[model samples]
Target: MTSYYTIDHLPGRTIQLDGQDYLFFSGTSYLGMAQHPAFQALLAEGMARYGTMFGSSRNGNLQLNIYGEAEAQLAAFARAEAALTLSSGMLAGQAVVNWLKAQGFGFIYGPKAHPAIWQDPSTSLPTVSFTDWTDQLPELVAAAATPNVVIALNSLDALCSVDYSFDWVNRLPDGQEVTLLVDDSHGFGVIGPEGSGVGALIPRRANVRLIVTASLAKAMGMPGGVIFADPETLRAIRHTAFFGACSPIPPAYLHAFGRAQALYRTAFERLQTNIARFENRIGLSDRFQHIPAYPVFYTEQDQLYSYLLANRILIYSFAYPTPADKPNTRIVISALHQPEDIEQLGDCLYGKTG
Candidate 1:
């Protein structure tokens, strides 16, 4: 039988459920900035400077400049020509899809692409057959007659246990230009130098146009979504009805985001250290390419969920944003997790007696 519990109280890495504290390993706040006093101070200061909400639409004549400032800062961090911020990462993905559809671009979706990219059933655009591997992408692109073809995928697919490599960018047949739309939601603020996302790992190429979108709510411990693209692309998107009609992210949050750069960098280092220790204790194989920021273990034989819960550890177990047939046990290690917590969880997973 399945049982349910609620978090009555939360204190950083630990949660109170059933009047007992349990170490949490299921949340996406990878850098642990959500509970940082310093980060909270910045948010409070922002709230003081800017009101709690900027309820006005972006299309309004009078608007706050904090939104533009935040977008510029994010663009510089992502090393892109320009950036746009939306209320949520899902909206950011939808904005991109809407732009592509408006531009008459056909899509070649990756097998493990996030549902947000193709969740809209009302879309009338054409889609090529889903390609499960990089080797099959070029032929599909070559066959498409559309002026622009988009290859949509996730930078790190934890569900399939695959980390995309840039080598595939070189394999695309010459003269067949394809745009890459990557949803790096899981990798942002977790991987790459200074948590710049997967774009930092892949060398920039002149042959392909790269566009990436991610949710700041994840590792960044902030709300909203950001899009990185060229100036022309961003400008075109900005002029769309979606951008003009939607409300901008709260001014105070954007102000806080602009000021939390240094904190994010510091937290990233600590998170990496915790990941390394956990991986060492668990003895992970080299073949597993999922990002260290997201420590997901795949097992069909072991009852690890019940085992961990019995030990007062909470983890996320579900098949979501992935094929329903394939489920994964996700253990998210954050910077807030203590060394002993990591060791204890590692010991539990490996059945090691300490």
Candidate 2:
């Protein structure tokens, strides 16, 4: 079939996989409440009050107080100086790249950096490709014989696992003025000990300026992406053609963020515990097959994804049309997930196949 539905032949929570309806386990829904009652309630309230789309930039007549509140909480939550709510997380990436280009900075990227970070910037930066950016980063930069570097980080990638004694952000080349941008798309609210972004987990490293951006689509279990940075930088982008020209979010999404912030801390602790449980019960200790995160164990992962789908279970998988090589399949634990769900997924992954 040219098009597909959920594995269970439903929408949202379910999507078609391998010719059968299955709970979509292959997307980033860390809190797993795409259909939560509160979400619905807020959505209805927003529809009644603010309509579906904001229809203009936040600077327009509709200075959505809800959107502003979400931005504030997001900045506070990310523990950054400030935040800007983008229509999407990916949009955040696009905006950032544009900003860097305007700054007239040359960029060098980690091997596994997200496509949005460097690939599209090919027209721009003096690029360097490395097998393992963590190991080759300094050497490659030293060899490049250039300065004015911008390092884009996707924390889940293996290149940045342990977070070291502190973080790689600090270990950046000593005399170079580095602009370290971390797209904590996967790490926000999910990996850190607190619901705070991963930036909070690691001690601030030297000359290690941070700019984090993430989609609320995943761990926030809602739609849209929020970009966090200092207020000055964010404000400067406000009038830029890219950001200033676009419509803002619907009131419904704004409401969703308020609800997410209220519940985020509790959900974080629950998911962390579940990760601990998955590791403890299976008698296995490892990181995700492709990315670096807590208790996302395994490798050679297609078999695991297939097994999960066949049993009517689901998780995020970066298989198929998205990218053929990266085994992006993932099981996102949620506050809504029961302890039993964890057991079942663990058993399926760890159980002996006779």
Candidate 3:
């Protein structure tokens, strides 16, 4: 019965929950820019200029200016050659899957493929769940039913527990034009040498074509999603139903996006400090046992979720079961969270299973 609460404050890591406010270590507002005055002003100004809803595709409104600039800003921010903004992260994911399917290619995803990947209707492709992308060669070789293999993965919070290294990605079998769709929603502004997060992982590779997509709700603390890749691939994806049929995002949002993308590079160190501080303080070394992803605290999720809710503290739980994998929950962390919030969350979990 732990319901989510919203605050008048911008979408930062920490905020009010019900009448009680806690340092929000949850959700994807990794760098705390969501609540920054500049970011907030961008949204406010955009709203004043363009109103809330565009309500139509590029056809009627021709608001391509906002889109193009945002795409450019995001590409530079994400270190991608180009980018596409989608209505939602899930839609962006579905867009790629649908497009790949329509092209008659096979996709072998990590064992923990986001549920939407499997929901795709394209049947001519092969889809496999990879538990360990680097070590699961036998599984992939045995499972792949087609020559073309497309892999959709999250860099840090991988659906599978794959390491975020170009080394393994380079090890990908040759002669196959394997398109790698990496979801860096969580890593975009928080990790890596430059706070480029997952982008820090890609520049080293030459063999594979890479595509990055993510939801702004998580890290940049916005409400939409971004697709990053080359212009040709982006052009190809734009023709899909999810990309073409849907209405464009409001022009006002471009401000938040622009500010977030601008700040992501500078804010990486602060976010990393926040991450390291929280990790050092907590002693979950004894109680939790699930695949590790960034600063997320994962374990027997369902029961932990119910237990924490009954106790009044709230958290998100991830529970996609892989092949031969048992269900679990993940406790996602954010940069805006204060030291106190981590202590409270630690007490909650430590008290439960410890």
Best by lDDT: 1
> Could you tell me how far off, in angstroms, the CA of residue 342 lies in candidate 2 after the best superposition?
2.7
What C-alpha root-mean-square deviation, in Å, does candidate 3 show against the real structure? 4.9
Instruction: Please rank every candidate by lDDT, starting with the best.
Output: 1, 3, 2
Report lDDT (Cα) of residue 117, candidate 3.
Answer: 46
lDDT at residue 315 of model 3 (Cα atoms): 60
lDDT by residue (tens digit), candidate 3, 1-354: 233355676545545656665444345555666666777787888888778867777544355578788889878776778988877777777777778888777766554445444436442332442334557753574468877677766675433223455566656665556777777766666555565557657744455678777776666666777777889988988866667787666667876676555566555555566556556655457445423335566554457666776565556654344335454455666655666666777677554323
TM-score of each: 0.90, 0.80, 0.77
Question: For model 2, what is the alpha-carbon lDDT of residue 300?
Answer: 46
lDDT of 1 by residue, 173-292 (tens): 678677889898888877667778878766566768889989888887777888889989888888899888887777788777788888888888888888888777766554233444
Worst 10 residues of 2 by lDDT: 1-10
Report lDDT (CA) for all predictions: 0.76, 0.63, 0.63
- The reply for model 1, stretches above 4 Å from the true place, is 122-132, 284-294, 319-327, 351-354
**Per-residue lDDT of candidate 2, residues 91-127 (tens digit):** 8877887888787766666545675566363434324
RMSD of each: 3.2, 4.4, 4.9
Q: Model 2: what TM-score?
A: 0.80
Error of 2 at 175 (Å): 3.1
Assess the local accuracy of residue 46 in candidate 3 as a C-alpha lDDT between 0 and 100.
81
